[model samples]
Target: MKTTLSVLVENHPGVLSRVAGLFSRRGFNIDSLAVGTTENPEISRMTIVVDGDEYIVEQVKKQLNKLVDVIKVSKIIPEESVSRELVLIKVDAEPQVRSEIIHIAEIFRANIVDVSRKSMIIELTGDKDKVSAFEELLKPFGIKELVRTGVIAVNRGNKTIKIEEDE
Candidate 1:
Protein backbone atom coordinates (compact mmCIF):
# COMPACT_ATOMS: atom_id res chain seq x y z
CA MET A 1 0.00 0.00 0.00
CA LYS A 2 1.13 3.56 -0.66
CA THR A 3 0.64 5.82 2.34
CA THR A 4 1.07 9.56 2.59
CA LEU A 5 2.07 11.08 5.91
CA SER A 6 1.89 14.76 6.83
CA VAL A 7 4.42 15.37 9.58
CA LEU A 8 4.67 18.68 11.40
CA VAL A 9 7.88 19.37 13.23
CA GLU A 10 9.79 22.25 14.74
CA ASN A 11 11.48 24.54 12.21
CA HIS A 12 14.89 23.47 13.33
CA PRO A 13 17.91 22.30 11.41
CA GLY A 14 18.66 18.55 11.36
CA VAL A 15 14.98 17.68 11.88
CA LEU A 16 14.61 16.53 8.31
CA SER A 17 17.79 14.52 8.54
CA ARG A 18 16.62 12.88 11.74
CA VAL A 19 13.27 11.96 10.27
CA ALA A 20 14.94 10.59 7.14
CA GLY A 21 17.43 8.66 9.27
CA LEU A 22 14.59 7.05 11.18
CA PHE A 23 13.05 5.81 7.96
CA SER A 24 16.42 4.54 6.79
CA ARG A 25 17.09 2.67 10.02
CA ARG A 26 13.67 1.04 9.82
CA GLY A 27 14.10 -0.03 6.19
CA PHE A 28 11.28 2.19 4.93
CA ASN A 29 11.82 3.65 1.49
CA ILE A 30 10.47 7.10 0.89
CA ASP A 31 8.86 7.48 -2.52
CA SER A 32 8.66 11.27 -2.33
CA LEU A 33 9.39 13.89 0.32
CA ALA A 34 8.47 17.58 0.24
CA VAL A 35 9.22 19.80 3.22
CA GLY A 36 8.52 23.46 3.73
CA THR A 37 7.50 26.01 6.29
CA THR A 38 3.88 26.09 7.36
CA GLU A 39 1.73 29.06 8.36
CA ASN A 40 3.55 29.20 11.68
CA PRO A 41 7.17 30.25 11.68
CA GLU A 42 8.08 27.73 14.35
CA ILE A 43 6.85 24.71 12.48
CA SER A 44 7.41 22.97 9.16
CA ARG A 45 5.38 20.34 7.42
CA MET A 46 6.81 17.37 5.62
CA THR A 47 4.69 15.57 3.07
CA ILE A 48 6.13 12.11 2.71
CA VAL A 49 5.01 9.23 0.52
CA VAL A 50 6.08 5.71 1.27
CA ASP A 51 5.12 2.21 0.21
CA GLY A 52 4.52 -0.20 3.07
CA ASP A 53 1.94 -2.39 4.75
CA GLU A 54 -0.71 -0.90 7.02
CA TYR A 55 1.16 -2.19 10.03
CA ILE A 56 4.31 -0.50 8.89
CA VAL A 57 2.46 2.74 8.39
CA GLU A 58 1.18 2.61 11.93
CA GLN A 59 4.67 1.87 13.22
CA VAL A 60 6.11 4.76 11.24
CA LYS A 61 3.59 7.17 12.74
CA LYS A 62 4.35 5.97 16.23
CA GLN A 63 8.06 6.41 15.71
CA LEU A 64 7.58 9.92 14.37
CA ASN A 65 5.56 10.91 17.39
CA LYS A 66 8.44 9.81 19.58
CA LEU A 67 10.81 12.30 18.02
CA VAL A 68 11.48 15.37 20.15
CA ASP A 69 11.10 17.86 17.34
CA VAL A 70 7.98 16.29 15.87
CA ILE A 71 4.80 18.23 16.55
CA LYS A 72 2.26 15.99 14.86
CA VAL A 73 1.85 13.23 12.28
CA SER A 74 -1.26 12.58 10.23
CA LYS A 75 -1.96 10.00 7.57
CA ILE A 76 -3.58 11.50 4.50
CA ILE A 77 -6.45 9.72 2.77
CA PRO A 78 -6.16 10.32 -0.97
CA GLU A 79 -9.89 10.60 -1.60
CA GLU A 80 -10.21 13.15 1.18
CA SER A 81 -7.20 15.22 0.14
CA VAL A 82 -5.86 17.30 -2.72
CA SER A 83 -2.27 16.91 -3.94
CA ARG A 84 -0.09 18.50 -6.60
CA GLU A 85 3.48 18.44 -7.88
CA LEU A 86 5.53 20.98 -9.80
CA VAL A 87 7.82 20.06 -12.69
CA LEU A 88 10.22 22.10 -14.80
CA ILE A 89 11.57 20.65 -17.99
CA LYS A 90 14.02 21.97 -20.54
CA VAL A 91 13.55 20.44 -23.97
CA ASP A 92 16.00 20.41 -26.86
CA ALA A 93 14.19 22.28 -29.61
CA GLU A 94 15.18 23.51 -33.05
CA PRO A 95 13.32 26.00 -35.22
CA GLN A 96 11.23 23.30 -36.90
CA VAL A 97 10.35 21.57 -33.65
CA ARG A 98 9.96 24.70 -31.53
CA SER A 99 6.45 25.38 -32.81
CA GLU A 100 5.39 21.80 -32.17
CA ILE A 101 6.82 21.95 -28.65
CA ILE A 102 5.00 25.16 -27.88
CA HIS A 103 1.76 23.65 -29.15
CA ILE A 104 2.18 20.60 -27.00
CA ALA A 105 2.94 22.75 -23.97
CA GLU A 106 -0.20 24.75 -24.63
CA ILE A 107 -2.26 21.56 -24.79
CA PHE A 108 -1.09 20.70 -21.30
CA ARG A 109 -1.47 24.29 -20.05
CA ALA A 110 2.20 24.40 -19.20
CA ASN A 111 4.01 27.72 -19.11
CA ILE A 112 7.01 28.39 -21.28
CA VAL A 113 9.08 30.05 -18.58
CA ASP A 114 12.23 30.41 -20.65
CA VAL A 115 13.11 30.05 -24.31
CA SER A 116 16.26 30.11 -26.37
CA ARG A 117 17.13 29.55 -30.00
CA LYS A 118 18.06 25.95 -29.26
CA SER A 119 15.79 24.98 -26.35
CA MET A 120 12.78 25.95 -24.26
CA ILE A 121 11.99 25.55 -20.60
CA ILE A 122 8.47 24.76 -19.44
CA GLU A 123 6.91 24.80 -16.02
CA LEU A 124 4.02 22.50 -15.19
CA THR A 125 2.01 21.83 -12.06
CA GLY A 126 -0.62 19.11 -11.66
CA ASP A 127 -1.44 15.78 -10.17
CA LYS A 128 1.00 12.91 -10.57
CA ASP A 129 -0.69 11.34 -13.57
CA LYS A 130 -1.10 14.65 -15.37
CA VAL A 131 2.55 15.52 -14.88
CA SER A 132 3.66 12.07 -16.01
CA ALA A 133 1.57 12.26 -19.17
CA PHE A 134 2.93 15.71 -19.98
CA GLU A 135 6.51 14.49 -19.59
CA GLU A 136 5.91 11.43 -21.74
CA LEU A 137 4.48 13.60 -24.51
CA LEU A 138 7.58 15.82 -24.49
CA LYS A 139 9.99 12.88 -24.46
CA PRO A 140 10.06 12.63 -28.25
CA PHE A 141 11.59 16.10 -28.47
CA GLY A 142 14.36 15.06 -26.10
CA ILE A 143 14.48 16.52 -22.61
CA LYS A 144 17.65 18.42 -21.76
CA GLU A 145 16.91 18.63 -18.06
CA LEU A 146 14.08 18.02 -15.61
CA VAL A 147 13.37 18.95 -12.00
CA ARG A 148 10.38 18.43 -9.75
CA THR A 149 9.07 19.39 -6.37
CA GLY A 150 7.74 16.17 -4.91
CA VAL A 151 4.08 15.78 -4.13
CA ILE A 152 2.59 18.19 -1.59
CA ALA A 153 -0.85 17.46 -0.20
CA VAL A 154 -3.44 18.61 2.27
CA ASN A 155 -6.80 17.31 3.43
CA ARG A 156 -9.98 18.81 2.01
CA GLY A 157 -11.72 21.71 3.75
CA ASN A 158 -13.35 21.48 7.19
CA LYS A 159 -10.46 19.42 8.48
CA THR A 160 -6.94 20.30 9.50
CA ILE A 161 -4.01 18.66 11.21
CA LYS A 162 -2.73 20.21 14.44
CA ILE A 163 -0.19 19.53 17.08
CA GLU A 164 -1.15 18.20 20.49
CA GLU A 165 0.67 19.63 23.47
CA ASP A 166 0.25 16.44 25.43
CA GLU A 167 1.66 14.22 22.72
Candidate 2:
Protein backbone atom coordinates (compact mmCIF):
# COMPACT_ATOMS: atom_id res chain seq x y z
CA MET A 1 0.00 0.00 0.00
CA LYS A 2 1.08 3.57 -0.63
CA THR A 3 0.86 5.79 2.45
CA THR A 4 1.10 9.54 2.47
CA LEU A 5 2.44 11.35 5.55
CA SER A 6 2.19 15.06 6.15
CA VAL A 7 4.98 16.00 8.55
CA LEU A 8 5.37 19.34 10.20
CA VAL A 9 8.83 20.37 11.34
CA GLU A 10 10.76 23.44 12.37
CA ASN A 11 12.31 25.27 9.44
CA HIS A 12 15.88 24.84 10.52
CA PRO A 13 18.94 23.96 8.49
CA GLY A 14 19.61 20.22 8.13
CA VAL A 15 16.06 19.37 9.20
CA LEU A 16 15.32 17.87 5.80
CA SER A 17 18.58 15.98 5.92
CA ARG A 18 17.83 14.47 9.33
CA VAL A 19 14.39 13.33 8.22
CA ALA A 20 15.77 11.88 5.00
CA GLY A 21 18.60 10.20 6.87
CA LEU A 22 16.13 8.54 9.21
CA PHE A 23 14.31 7.06 6.25
CA SER A 24 17.60 6.01 4.70
CA ARG A 25 18.78 4.28 7.88
CA ARG A 26 15.49 2.44 8.18
CA GLY A 27 15.84 1.14 4.60
CA PHE A 28 12.47 2.59 3.70
CA ASN A 29 12.19 3.96 0.20
CA ILE A 30 10.44 7.27 -0.27
CA ASP A 31 8.43 7.33 -3.48
CA SER A 32 7.94 11.06 -3.42
CA LEU A 33 8.78 13.98 -1.14
CA ALA A 34 7.80 17.65 -1.29
CA VAL A 35 8.77 20.25 1.29
CA GLY A 36 8.17 23.95 1.68
CA THR A 37 7.66 26.54 4.37
CA THR A 38 4.18 26.85 5.75
CA GLU A 39 2.23 30.03 6.50
CA ASN A 40 4.55 30.50 9.44
CA PRO A 41 8.09 30.80 8.12
CA GLU A 42 9.46 29.13 11.20
CA ILE A 43 7.76 25.90 10.24
CA SER A 44 7.68 23.72 7.16
CA ARG A 45 5.55 20.84 5.93
CA MET A 46 6.86 17.71 4.24
CA THR A 47 4.51 15.62 2.20
CA ILE A 48 6.05 12.19 1.71
CA VAL A 49 4.73 9.14 -0.03
CA VAL A 50 6.06 5.68 0.78
CA ASP A 51 5.06 2.17 -0.14
CA GLY A 52 4.66 -0.14 2.81
CA ASP A 53 2.13 -2.16 4.72
CA GLU A 54 0.12 -0.73 7.64
CA TYR A 55 2.53 -1.97 10.31
CA ILE A 56 5.52 -0.58 8.46
CA VAL A 57 3.84 2.77 8.04
CA GLU A 58 2.94 2.92 11.72
CA GLN A 59 6.54 2.21 12.68
CA VAL A 60 7.79 4.87 10.30
CA LYS A 61 5.38 7.41 11.78
CA LYS A 62 6.57 6.66 15.29
CA GLN A 63 10.17 7.03 14.23
CA LEU A 64 9.45 10.35 12.50
CA ASN A 65 7.83 11.74 15.63
CA LYS A 66 11.00 11.09 17.63
CA LEU A 67 13.07 13.51 15.52
CA VAL A 68 13.89 16.71 17.41
CA ASP A 69 12.82 18.99 14.58
CA VAL A 70 9.56 17.19 13.89
CA ILE A 71 6.44 18.83 15.27
CA LYS A 72 3.64 16.60 13.99
CA VAL A 73 3.00 13.76 11.56
CA SER A 74 -0.39 12.93 10.11
CA LYS A 75 -1.33 10.08 7.83
CA ILE A 76 -3.41 11.42 4.98
CA ILE A 77 -6.47 9.39 4.07
CA PRO A 78 -6.67 9.45 0.31
CA GLU A 79 -10.42 9.96 0.16
CA GLU A 80 -10.27 12.81 2.67
CA SER A 81 -7.32 14.70 1.27
CA VAL A 82 -6.64 16.66 -1.90
CA SER A 83 -3.32 16.05 -3.59
CA ARG A 84 -1.62 17.37 -6.70
CA GLU A 85 1.63 17.11 -8.67
CA LEU A 86 3.05 19.33 -11.37
CA VAL A 87 4.88 18.08 -14.45
CA LEU A 88 6.67 19.79 -17.30
CA ILE A 89 7.25 17.72 -20.38
CA LYS A 90 9.23 18.76 -23.42
CA VAL A 91 8.18 16.90 -26.52
CA ASP A 92 9.42 16.84 -30.08
CA ALA A 93 7.21 19.08 -32.23
CA GLU A 94 7.75 19.55 -35.91
CA PRO A 95 5.57 22.23 -37.56
CA GLN A 96 3.29 19.55 -38.99
CA VAL A 97 2.70 17.97 -35.61
CA ARG A 98 2.59 21.12 -33.48
CA SER A 99 -1.12 21.70 -33.97
CA GLU A 100 -1.88 18.07 -33.19
CA ILE A 101 0.10 18.33 -29.95
CA ILE A 102 -1.62 21.57 -29.00
CA HIS A 103 -5.03 19.96 -29.48
CA ILE A 104 -4.04 17.06 -27.26
CA ALA A 105 -2.78 19.42 -24.56
CA GLU A 106 -6.08 21.31 -24.74
CA ILE A 107 -8.02 18.11 -24.13
CA PHE A 108 -6.10 17.62 -20.89
CA ARG A 109 -6.26 21.31 -20.01
CA ALA A 110 -2.47 21.49 -19.98
CA ASN A 111 -0.59 24.61 -20.97
CA ILE A 112 2.05 25.00 -23.64
CA VAL A 113 4.50 26.92 -21.53
CA ASP A 114 7.22 27.08 -24.17
CA VAL A 115 7.54 26.48 -27.86
CA SER A 116 10.30 26.35 -30.44
CA ARG A 117 10.74 25.06 -33.97
CA LYS A 118 11.66 21.59 -32.71
CA SER A 119 9.86 21.19 -29.38
CA MET A 120 7.25 22.42 -26.93
CA ILE A 121 7.17 22.37 -23.15
CA ILE A 122 3.80 21.38 -21.72
CA GLU A 123 2.93 21.97 -18.09
CA LEU A 124 0.23 20.06 -16.29
CA THR A 125 -0.89 19.81 -12.71
CA GLY A 126 -3.34 17.24 -11.37
CA ASP A 127 -3.76 14.02 -9.47
CA LYS A 128 -1.38 11.11 -10.13
CA ASP A 129 -3.74 9.33 -12.48
CA LYS A 130 -4.42 12.40 -14.54
CA VAL A 131 -0.74 13.21 -14.84
CA SER A 132 0.11 9.67 -15.83
CA ALA A 133 -2.58 9.64 -18.51
CA PHE A 134 -1.30 12.90 -19.93
CA GLU A 135 2.26 11.61 -20.08
CA GLU A 136 1.17 8.45 -21.86
CA LEU A 137 -0.60 10.48 -24.53
CA LEU A 138 2.51 12.56 -25.16
CA LYS A 139 4.98 9.68 -25.33
CA PRO A 140 4.36 9.17 -29.05
CA PHE A 141 5.62 12.68 -29.60
CA GLY A 142 9.00 11.73 -28.07
CA ILE A 143 9.54 13.19 -24.64
CA LYS A 144 12.86 15.03 -24.78
CA GLU A 145 12.80 16.06 -21.14
CA LEU A 146 10.51 15.84 -18.16
CA VAL A 147 10.45 17.16 -14.63
CA ARG A 148 7.95 16.69 -11.84
CA THR A 149 7.27 18.26 -8.50
CA GLY A 150 6.38 15.43 -6.18
CA VAL A 151 2.94 15.21 -4.62
CA ILE A 152 1.85 17.93 -2.21
CA ALA A 153 -1.39 17.55 -0.29
CA VAL A 154 -3.65 18.68 2.49
CA ASN A 155 -6.83 17.54 4.14
CA ARG A 156 -10.15 18.62 2.67
CA GLY A 157 -12.80 20.48 4.64
CA ASN A 158 -12.35 21.71 8.22
CA LYS A 159 -9.61 19.36 9.28
CA THR A 160 -6.10 20.79 9.33
CA ILE A 161 -2.72 20.09 10.87
CA LYS A 162 -1.74 22.44 13.67
CA ILE A 163 0.88 22.51 16.37
CA GLU A 164 -0.13 20.72 19.58
CA GLU A 165 -0.01 23.95 21.57
CA ASP A 166 -2.30 25.72 19.11
CA GLU A 167 -5.05 23.14 19.43
Candidate 3:
Protein backbone atom coordinates (compact mmCIF):
# COMPACT_ATOMS: atom_id res chain seq x y z
CA MET A 1 0.00 0.00 0.00
CA LYS A 2 1.06 3.61 -0.51
CA THR A 3 1.47 5.83 2.53
CA THR A 4 2.11 9.54 2.88
CA LEU A 5 4.37 10.53 5.74
CA SER A 6 4.61 14.04 7.12
CA VAL A 7 7.84 14.67 9.00
CA LEU A 8 8.74 17.73 11.01
CA VAL A 9 12.46 18.27 11.45
CA GLU A 10 14.86 20.89 12.70
CA ASN A 11 15.75 23.44 10.07
CA HIS A 12 19.38 22.53 10.13
CA PRO A 13 21.90 21.49 7.55
CA GLY A 14 22.34 17.74 7.01
CA VAL A 15 18.95 16.89 8.53
CA LEU A 16 17.44 16.05 5.16
CA SER A 17 20.50 14.05 4.21
CA ARG A 18 20.34 12.08 7.44
CA VAL A 19 16.65 11.28 7.05
CA ALA A 20 17.11 10.27 3.42
CA GLY A 21 20.12 8.16 4.35
CA LEU A 22 18.09 6.32 6.96
CA PHE A 23 15.48 5.36 4.36
CA SER A 24 18.17 4.30 1.90
CA ARG A 25 20.00 2.18 4.48
CA ARG A 26 16.75 0.37 5.22
CA GLY A 27 16.17 -0.27 1.50
CA PHE A 28 12.97 1.80 1.50
CA ASN A 29 12.29 3.59 -1.76
CA ILE A 30 10.60 6.98 -1.43
CA ASP A 31 8.20 7.61 -4.29
CA SER A 32 8.04 11.37 -3.79
CA LEU A 33 9.42 13.98 -1.37
CA ALA A 34 8.66 17.64 -0.90
CA VAL A 35 10.28 19.77 1.79
CA GLY A 36 9.43 23.33 2.62
CA THR A 37 9.42 25.85 5.42
CA THR A 38 6.56 25.85 7.87
CA GLU A 39 4.97 28.72 9.76
CA ASN A 40 7.83 28.41 12.18
CA PRO A 41 11.13 28.98 10.42
CA GLU A 42 13.04 26.87 12.91
CA ILE A 43 11.30 23.77 11.57
CA SER A 44 10.84 22.34 8.11
CA ARG A 45 8.06 20.02 7.00
CA MET A 46 8.78 17.13 4.67
CA THR A 47 6.04 15.14 2.98
CA ILE A 48 7.18 11.77 1.67
CA VAL A 49 5.27 9.10 -0.17
CA VAL A 50 6.44 5.52 0.18
CA ASP A 51 5.10 2.12 -0.82
CA GLY A 52 5.05 -0.54 1.90
CA ASP A 53 2.78 -2.73 3.95
CA GLU A 54 1.25 -1.39 7.16
CA TYR A 55 3.73 -3.17 9.43
CA ILE A 56 6.73 -2.04 7.39
CA VAL A 57 5.49 1.51 7.31
CA GLU A 58 5.06 1.53 11.08
CA GLN A 59 8.61 0.28 11.48
CA VAL A 60 9.89 3.02 9.18
CA LYS A 61 8.08 5.68 11.22
CA LYS A 62 9.52 4.26 14.43
CA GLN A 63 13.02 4.37 12.95
CA LEU A 64 12.50 7.92 11.76
CA ASN A 65 11.45 9.04 15.23
CA LYS A 66 14.81 7.78 16.54
CA LEU A 67 16.73 10.36 14.53
CA VAL A 68 17.92 13.40 16.49
CA ASP A 69 16.86 15.93 13.89
CA VAL A 70 13.47 14.40 13.32
CA ILE A 71 10.94 16.18 15.51
CA LYS A 72 7.85 14.15 14.63
CA VAL A 73 6.32 11.90 11.98
CA SER A 74 2.81 10.84 11.00
CA LYS A 75 1.41 8.64 8.25
CA ILE A 76 -1.52 10.42 6.56
CA ILE A 77 -3.83 7.90 4.91
CA PRO A 78 -6.92 8.75 2.84
CA GLU A 79 -9.37 7.57 5.47
CA GLU A 80 -7.86 9.97 8.01
CA SER A 81 -6.93 13.04 5.99
CA VAL A 82 -7.15 15.19 2.93
CA SER A 83 -4.24 15.07 0.47
CA ARG A 84 -3.38 17.25 -2.50
CA GLU A 85 -0.70 17.78 -5.14
CA LEU A 86 0.22 20.46 -7.63
CA VAL A 87 1.37 20.02 -11.22
CA LEU A 88 2.45 22.15 -14.15
CA ILE A 89 2.34 20.88 -17.71
CA LYS A 90 3.59 22.38 -20.92
CA VAL A 91 1.98 21.10 -24.09
CA ASP A 92 2.40 21.78 -27.78
CA ALA A 93 -0.41 24.02 -28.95
CA GLU A 94 -0.63 25.42 -32.44
CA PRO A 95 -3.38 27.88 -33.28
CA GLN A 96 -5.82 25.18 -34.26
CA VAL A 97 -5.17 23.05 -31.18
CA ARG A 98 -4.80 25.89 -28.67
CA SER A 99 -8.52 26.37 -28.18
CA GLU A 100 -9.09 22.67 -27.77
CA ILE A 101 -6.37 22.41 -25.17
CA ILE A 102 -7.70 25.44 -23.35
CA HIS A 103 -11.16 23.90 -23.35
CA ILE A 104 -9.85 20.76 -21.78
CA ALA A 105 -7.88 22.75 -19.25
CA GLU A 106 -10.98 24.65 -18.32
CA ILE A 107 -12.84 21.41 -17.83
CA PHE A 108 -10.17 20.32 -15.39
CA ARG A 109 -10.23 23.77 -13.75
CA ALA A 110 -6.54 24.17 -14.60
CA ASN A 111 -5.20 27.63 -15.19
CA ILE A 112 -3.29 28.58 -18.30
CA VAL A 113 -0.34 30.33 -16.80
CA ASP A 114 1.49 30.86 -20.06
CA VAL A 115 0.63 30.79 -23.73
CA SER A 116 2.81 31.22 -26.78
CA ARG A 117 2.50 30.65 -30.50
CA LYS A 118 3.26 26.95 -30.18
CA SER A 119 2.84 26.02 -26.54
CA MET A 120 0.72 26.47 -23.44
CA ILE A 121 1.74 26.07 -19.85
CA ILE A 122 -0.99 25.03 -17.42
CA GLU A 123 -1.05 25.04 -13.66
CA LEU A 124 -3.20 22.51 -11.79
CA THR A 125 -3.70 21.91 -8.11
CA GLY A 126 -5.87 19.13 -6.74
CA ASP A 127 -5.83 15.68 -5.25
CA LYS A 128 -3.56 13.11 -6.88
CA ASP A 129 -6.32 11.33 -8.78
CA LYS A 130 -7.67 14.50 -10.33
CA VAL A 131 -4.23 15.61 -11.41
CA SER A 132 -3.49 12.21 -12.90
CA ALA A 133 -6.77 12.23 -14.79
CA PHE A 134 -6.00 15.65 -16.24
CA GLU A 135 -2.56 14.53 -17.32
CA GLU A 136 -3.96 11.42 -18.96
CA LEU A 137 -6.42 13.56 -20.91
CA LEU A 138 -3.58 15.72 -22.22
CA LYS A 139 -1.32 12.83 -23.23
CA PRO A 140 -2.51 12.76 -26.82
CA PHE A 141 -1.83 16.46 -27.23
CA GLY A 142 1.93 15.91 -26.93
CA ILE A 143 3.25 17.13 -23.60
CA LYS A 144 6.49 19.06 -23.94
CA GLU A 145 7.38 18.79 -20.29
CA LEU A 146 5.81 18.58 -16.83
CA VAL A 147 6.63 19.04 -13.18
CA ARG A 148 4.81 18.10 -9.99
CA THR A 149 4.96 18.97 -6.33
CA GLY A 150 4.24 15.66 -4.67
CA VAL A 151 1.45 14.92 -2.25
CA ILE A 152 0.99 16.99 0.92
CA ALA A 153 -1.70 16.28 3.42
CA VAL A 154 -3.33 17.29 6.66
CA ASN A 155 -5.86 15.62 8.86
CA ARG A 156 -9.42 16.86 8.51
CA GLY A 157 -10.44 20.18 10.05
CA ASN A 158 -8.82 21.05 13.38
CA LYS A 159 -6.70 17.92 13.77
CA THR A 160 -2.95 18.04 13.22
CA ILE A 161 0.20 16.24 14.29
CA LYS A 162 2.54 18.90 15.52
CA ILE A 163 6.02 18.41 16.89
CA GLU A 164 6.61 19.33 20.49
CA GLU A 165 9.84 20.86 21.68
CA ASP A 166 12.27 18.38 23.18
CA GLU A 167 13.06 19.46 26.68
Residue-by-residue lDDT tens digits, candidate 3, 29-50: 7888889889989999999998
**Compared with the true structure, what per-residue lDDT tens digits does model 1 show for residues 20-78?**
99999998878899999999989999999988998889999999999999988999999
Residue 59 of model 3: what lDDT? Answer: 84
TM-score of 2: 0.97
RMSD of each: 1.4, 1.1, 1.3
> For candidate 1, which ten residues in a row score worst on lDDT?
158-167
TM-score of each: 0.95, 0.97, 0.95
Give lDDT per model, in order.
Answer: 0.94, 0.95, 0.91
Clashes of each: 0, 0, 0
Evaluated at residue 14, the lDDT of candidate 3 is: 96
Error of 1 at 91 (Å): 0.8
TM-score, ranked from best to worst? 2, 1, 3
